[model samples]
Target chain A: MLDVKAEAAEHSGAGAPGEEAPPLVVEGLGHAFGERQALRNVSFRLNRGDRTMLLGLNGAGKTTLFSLITRLYNHRSGSIRIFGFEIKDKPSEALARLGVVFQLATLDLELSVAQNLLYHAALHGLPRREAAVRLKREIERVGLTDRLREHARTLSGGQRRRVEIARALVHQPKLLLLDEPTVGLDVASRQFLLDHVRMLCNEGGIAALWATHLIDEVDSGARVIVLHHGQILAEGPVPEVIRRANASSMREAFDKLTGERSE
Target chain B: MRPIHYARCLRGIIWREALRFINQRGRFLAALVRPLVWLLIFATGFRFVLGVSIIPPYQTYIPYQVYIAPGLIGMILMFQGMQSSLSMVWDRETGSMRTLLVSPLPRWYLLTSKLIAAVIVSVLQAYVFLFIAYFWGVHPPRLGYLTVLPALILAGMMLSGLGLFLSSVIRQLENFAGVMNFVIFPMFFASSALYPLWTVKQANLKLYYICMANPFTHAVELIRFALYEKFNLEAFAVVGGSLVIFMTLAILGYDPGRGLIARRAGTE
Candidate 1:
């Protein structure tokens, strides 16, 4: 929808040799809430241009892991690095390259769509002129240019999610993290979002980690991390995981790996 | 991050606060009405019962309405401070706080910017109250109008610090109503807000001691003296010291690694 080719060309030859570290890397990440462990020894990596799906059920610690990696909750037992910058020691550097679409709606309902996008851009330290340009471009790409002046409350669920996706891209982050972004969307909206994110990874060279519990959302060739009970049960391509789980379909593989039947 | 980036961040936060205030027309009306009701009805009824005396800020005996104007200003700031904290709790529940916390800026800077924005809104409300009280036959010295600003800022910051600390400890929105009754009412009533501290001393010694120990009492005295273009060194010292303590505790309370947030990350 955007000038993806031009933007991709701009970033194509930027990184030097040996400077292209994976967009994200988590090592032995563990987190807890008092006596309850939320995430334990979770590890993963996302290379440039990779669109990895982090598949987990409710309370499977997917949100907990995202919180730790996003630095919303501090991790005590492990480390998270973004583009070679450790989150604990170099938070600013690490967070600057991250774009997140939280599970809950975070838009200020009183503020217009453009205002919300501009506020996010300012938070990421974008210059006023640059922020305005990106705000316009991103809103246009999301097909909401005419609705820019409308308050977030006026938009439908799908439109709000699209606006959020556009907001996340305003700062041009290197790593995008979405936690159940399509939870309540319609069939078309869900497909649109999934395709848009995949396009970003394929054309714009941005790496993404999409967290979802829906089994049908995963593509057969894409890398996936199946999490269960605060631990990753499987990691690899879909076919490899299904085969390793001694199942014929992704749904069966997930049920077998998590030791639960799908209702 | 560059200094310019920090400035941009501050501007954005302040702008959002201003926009939210403008959008919430009912909140602004309520902020003004709460103080006005006290100035108009409560003070009018108490005028006959309460006798005025010559205080440091008062050269001669003043009417009950004039005597209570500064207290009402302090009331505006305190109520607004608490109101802002309520919004913070709401923000956390609604998930907007997560967006703010995940920003690249340091947590301290973000929290401070929030405090400063709240203070600006409260100060604006205070000035509007002062303006309305002017037509109601209550007038401080002309210079008092100009001098009361810094005093309001200091008092606003202190009250907001208390508010921020409360918001960090508060778990649910339902608990905030309990806090308003326990924390707000006691602080307002036990202080020298309604009557002079000397009057409280004459009536009950124990109440006078509690009033003296209350930070809200110093905040009231600070505003009371500053509105008359005079300085109260004691009130100034107490308010400033309390501000430091409250702000430090609030910053720690919101800290992710060590404070209450770390203990219970469920709500935050």
Candidate 2:
């Protein structure tokens, strides 16, 4: 086993009493694929128990940033700390507290929904009894209790998304990262996933960073970080970013921030 | 992660692989068909023409079927290795590999677990081939069946490791079929899988050296000796060394820093 105590000390000194660290803190993060830069100087912080929308168009580096945060790709110039644990220096410790729902469908189409969740639970090192309990709870949250025995391929697009979210939550991660969670979902399914995540923030008290291209998915009160062309263009609450850009709507604001002159 | 967590993760991956294999009835059948065809058709045709010498593992001249049975076993495993690697490409294209990568488990554990799973399937296929070959009159000495288990496992590991390395290098699933044709046939035909290395030396010295140098040749030799309840130290060293080397390359190929999978994220 890795020396957890040494890793904790190496990344961040002991915290003061009653001072809880933010869920995520990233700074000066940059990544390039050969000569083409995918992300440059991206920085952000997510408060505990808050939902943040990562708004960007396709090819805007949302997936790249998520890949770095999830440790799927290492950034060349940047730092990502999850709950005060550096991603590069202490990946296991940092990743243990994180849950992710990727943009692509990751479920085993051949396996039952319950089986898929149980497998994921085992991957997280949850024992059988504990995994079963968590699995049932999360499945209920996603409203797929009856479909548990069905193959994932038999489910609708939204149902599969819910199952994925449930699978991500079964391990009780402190932070959830969803990359374009609603890309292929119908209107109702998209709303269902968003509402469920909101409930998780409010009730379960889990912090989340939801990535999406559609601007309407960004609730007014939610913290918004706009990424365009591999760089952060604007970050703050929705109203503030819009007012700063002198745009009336979030769409217009995004256009202006990305330098897309309105015709 | 604790040792227990690592064990749990490995178990999950292996179980999932087992589940996938069980569901793919066509793949299992295809795995058996290729080796069986070679054992029945090719070996039968060559049985009259080729005469195996009194190799250390063999006390007398052996029939071509008996000679090539172990080679066919090697063929089965080589195909299995490539088959598993092909699935790796499919998993990447389908995004299941990403789910696995994001896990808190070390990348080495995740990848090794995958390789072990492929080894398990290949080993199972080898036994099935052995069972069929037994009834087909290619029986080794009485103890050969029992003795071949370790040989199959060792050979399976080496071949699966090679497959994992190939999966890490081959970028596209469509391209893998072509690569597999180039790899599986060459590794199977260039080695002692069909004829003795001495026979190749008799016919062509250069082809003999290439056969002797091929790791699949060593794998077949390892199994060939083990099936006769004998041992071949040279074959053991070659297969073992190749396992370590290929496994290392595969593990490095999966590292997020410089591996092929890292480039996949940007392209996607």
Angstrom error at residue B43, model 2: 1.9
Model 2 DockQ class: medium
- iRMS per model, in Å, is 2.0, 1.9
- Alpha-carbon lDDT, every model: 0.85, 0.84
Provide TM-scores for the models.
0.94, 0.93
Q: How accurately is candidate 2 docked according to DockQ?
A: 0.54
Model 1 chain B weakest 10-residue run by lDDT? B85-94
Best of the candidates, TM-score: 1
Candidate 1 A-chain TM? 0.91
Per-residue lDDT tens digits for candidate 2, residues B140-241, read 887988898899999988998888887777665456567667888788889988877887898999988888889999999999999999889999999999
Task: Enumerate residue pairs that collide in model 2.
Answer: none
- Docking quality of model 1: it rates as medium
Over 4 Å off, model 1: A1-19, B92-94, B172-175, B266-268
